[model samples]
Target chain A: MWYIAAMALSIGFGLSLAALAGAFGQSRAVSSALEGMARQPEAAGQIQTAMIIGLAFIESLVIYVLVIAFLLNGKIPAVDTIAAVMEKAH
Target chain B: MSLELPGWLAVAEEVFIGYFGPSYHESEAVFHAALVIPLLLLFVFLSTRRLEKIPTGLQNFAELLVELLSKFCTSLIGPHGLAFLPLIGALFLYIFTMNMFGLIPGFKSPTSNVNVTCSLALVTFVATHYYGFRYQGMGYLKHFAGEPLWLAPLMFPIHIVGELARPLSLTLRLYGNIMGEDTAIAVFIGMGIGAGYLPFQFPMMALAVFTSFVQAMIFALLSSIYISGATTVHEHHAAHGEEHGHGAHGAAQAPAHA
Candidate 1:
């Protein structure tokens, strides 16, 4: 029971932190790219491509955390198992 | 997790199991991947059947796709990149089509599966190293040796690890994104069913369309960047530094008007 709770908590906390970091990193990248584009309108195309790639890289890091959360989620007991445990305890 | 739509292939699997006494099972991802190949082949064949100086209909669309892909290849990997048009173009089409397949009510994205994405990433991995060796010969090994020569010991292992991580990261990135998107849509759809089929997943489906295109382009772009990095000669790197730049910065700046 404790194990399951810990896993769930870790997954939630880990994902939240990852999402927070990813949002900050992506926003920074987009803002910098937008500034660059504004400064040199002719180079907007290049800036946009760079920004997208940077976003992907940052997004991938968050996805890594997501994958880990998924793996942890799998370790949690299924509903049927949990129900069986409760019945046995009672 | 419990509520999910059945893809066409899943329905077929059910029929097959009924006939074959539960002994036969086929993966939906495999079926979808197979379906995509024949569809792409047919499209290409039809589009190229009657080429003209002044294109029309499917021919025009085909030319546009080819032109865009060609420009993408050349812009990233230089003039010689045209040689890889077939590989990169096929990958772009295959991945894009598979990604879009999930949006269809009776279809699922093959790329949402790790096996499919792993195989695709492995192809890029193999091709990158192959082109590296073919173009740079034994000097390709020097890539791991790092610059300044004395840092070989520290850099060699790091480079090898980085090289290995590329395909792993590629596999996970594509698989995770598509799978997450598909799962989100499925969950929303399940919720909608409880809510009297309210089309709750509509927004997600719309977002999937944009993400599908962006993911496909990113995969192709990253593949081209890897290939160009591997194929570029050591001296050429310095020579083209001003014109082409290097790494992501160079690739970003390559096609100013693109």
Candidate 2:
């Protein structure tokens, strides 16, 4: 029980760090895009599109970490069903 | 913390029968590593066999490849980077080949494995600090200690944790992407065959190819960026000196502000 709680807390902490990093990354990317647009006004459309795509890629890493955290926390329904059955039999 | 699931959800299955050491595991990443080792070795042997002042055919192509890689590294690490060209080139080629291996039949991409991705990330982690130390000597250790005595408490943990996170994030990102794509393709293939929907494989195949290439590019680009960051010294004062000119006023005032 304590072990599981600790594991969950760590996962939650890791996820928050990832989220914070991602937020910082996205803001920096947007600011860079805005700066580029200011430098070359005509290329704003292209710059914005590229920035959005890049932001998606960067954010996807955080999403991947979140999925892993969920997986690690043993939250999958199929696996939980099997484990429940095994525990009942035991 | 391990899941035991049945049918296609079970990630491992024998892909092929072989007369060699063991039965070739279909989804096992070690099989991919075994294939990559020899392919990379052969490439290295052939490319390094002969020296040519004026090159032609395969040698010309190989030299051109090295030249381009050299230019990329040099631009990232400055002119002195040519010394590390062989290491970076091998890393890029090995990673690129390992990544492309997923497109081959009956072979999983070794890089698609978290263990393999972590190994690669660890290599990069070591290489970054190794080069940093090589260039800057023992003072490279000071990077962790913070610039001044006052901020060490705050900066120390942040710097250390951030450094540790690099490999974890790098490995997890690459592994998650490649493995997820591989799983999706497998699921698609299984479902398509079951439903007699063969056309579904085409789009999945196209997606797999695109994902493999993009993952390889991202891995290489991130590794290069990390190497550049680790090696290049941040010259905050130099920039200030340039702005205010290199006279006595600039140098004395900057120290006063500090």
Candidate 3:
């Protein structure tokens, strides 16, 4: 029970953190692109492209953390089944 | 609280119904693979076989997809990206097709199964490094080793962990969105269990459809990004920094103005 509870809390916290980081990264990307456009609208195309690439890299990092939370939360396969089978054999 | 099938997959399945059967629910992966593979191949054949000097009908649609994906990939990976197009395009199409399968009446999405997504992600994960090595050669293995010997111990595990996490993240993200969307749709549709019209069902159904489209697009976009990152040389960053001057724009820029 405690294990599940701990997993749940961690997942909640990790997802929230991922959401926050994604929002910040996305906004920063948009803002930077806008600034570049304001300064040199002709470069908007290039700037926007770079911003998106950078934003994706940032988002991937957050997704990485989300993956960890997922594994911890038992969304990935758990060892319990294998352990139980072994215990039965013993 | 309630769920309904996405319209696109529903329409697709309606077009080719008995290609899938009621009893054959468990082997969703094979069913989806069979259903989508032909349609996708047909699309490719139709799109390419014409050799059109001027685009029309299927040719136009093919060109449009090509243009969109090429531009998107090139934007992220830079020029000389044409080489990676076939793999990236196939990945995106396969994922989106499998995801949309969930909305079909008798067909569950293969992607809704972790086993399926994991396999797909593993392929992408392997492909990413394969491309990385193809471009950079055995020297690409250096990325796993820290430049400074001192940081090697700390950085090596982090690098390994990060790479391992990529496939897991990709699989989970795709699985979660599709499964959640399908579950929501099912619940909404099931509300009609009691009532005839199923009051308040229409809006939920519409939202579920929208979610499906968004999730499909997100998966395609992210996969493209990963592929692009894998294929590109990191030298561009140094060149870009020199050109853009991230240092020049300093803290003098007002926070609110930003």
Candidate 4:
């Protein structure tokens, strides 16, 4: 029971933390890229490409966490199953 | 939360099972991917049937796509990058089509499946190293060895890990994003069914279109970057600092931006 609860909690907390960090990172990257484009509109294309690449790289990290959450989610048994196992153990 | 949209291919599978027994099972993703390939080939065949100096209709669309991809390849990978247009352009079209396929009723996005994305990433991984060796020969291994000769032992392992991580990251990134998007759309669709058949997922479908394009573009862009990084010689790497700078910036900016 405790194990299942912990696993569920970790998945939630892990995803939320990753989302928070990813959002911050993406915002910073877009802001800087926008500023650069504003300074040199002619170079906006180059800056935009760089920005998207940077965003993808950052986004991949969050995706890594999501994958881990998925793996952990799979490991979790149903609450009813756990309760039944506990009853049997008793 | 485990609700999933039923794909048309599932019905086909059922018919096959009824006719051929249980031995004829096939995944919907595989069916969708197979369906997409022939459709893509048919499009290419139709578009190229009659080449015209003054393009129109399908020919114009095909030419525009090729031209945009050509420019993107050249801009990112220099003149030599044109050699990779076939691979990059094919990836963009295939991935974009697969991503958007989920928006159609009774169809699923093949890209939402990790196995499909993993295979695509493997192609990029193999192509990257193949071009690396083709361009640099045995000297390509020197890249794993850092600037200081003493650092070779440490740097070699780090480089190997980084190289391996590239495909893994690519696989997970594409798989997770598409899977999440599809699942969201499915959940919304489920809600719509409960709400007297309101199209609750219409807005999500619009967002999916944007994300599908972005994801496809990113996949193509990163594959080109990886290939270019592997193929360019050290001399060109230093000389074209501005062009190479994007690769370095992409790596360095990750943590700082985060």
| Candidate 3 residue lDDT tens string, B1-258 | 113344444555567776655434445466576788898898899888968799889889988988887765565445756676776677777777777666656566777666788887888788778887898687566566645557778878887887787677777767666665676567766777556756545675466566555555555555555555455455554445432111111111111111
In model 1, where do residues sit more than 4 Å from their true spots? Answer: B1-4, B16-26, B236-258
| Among all candidates shown, the one with the greatest lDDT | 4
**How would the docking of model 3 be graded?**
incorrect
Which residue pairs in candidate 2 have backbone atoms (N, alpha carbon, C) closer than 3 angstroms, thus clashing?
A: none
| Alpha-carbon shift of residue A46 in model 4 (angstroms) | 1.2
lDDT of 2: 0.66
TM-score of chain B of each: 0.89, 0.76, 0.76, 0.89
Docking level for model 4: acceptable
DockQ of each model vs. true complex: 0.49, 0.16, 0.09, 0.45
lDDT of 1 at A85: 99
lDDT of 4 by residue, B120-230 (tens): 999999999999899989878877775555888997888888889888888988988888888889889889999999999999999999999999998998898888778
In order, the interface RMSDs are: 2.9, 11.4, 9.6, 6.2
Better model by TM-score: candidate 3 vs candidate 4: 4
Expressed as tens digits, the lDDT of each residue in A2-66 for candidate 4 is: 77888899999999999999999999999999999999998787778788888998998998888
lDDT of each: 0.83, 0.66, 0.64, 0.84
For candidate 2, the per-residue lDDT at B97 reads 79
Please, what are the lDDT tens digits per residue for candidate 2 over residues B1-258?
Answer: 222112221233333334333533434566667678798778767877886888867778888988888875665455566777777777777777777676665566777667888998898889878887887677665566565547878867877887788777778877777766666666777778898867565788788777776666566555655665556554573345333221112212222211
* Count of clashes, each model: 0, 0, 7, 0
Q: Give one digit per residue, the lDDT tens place, for model 1 in B1-258.
A: 222477875677677766644523347788788989999999999999988999999999999999999988987777788999998998899999999999999888999888999999999999999998999899888777765568889978887888898898888999888888898899999899999989999999999999889888889988887888788775664445443323444446545424
Comparison by DockQ, 2 against 4, better one? 4
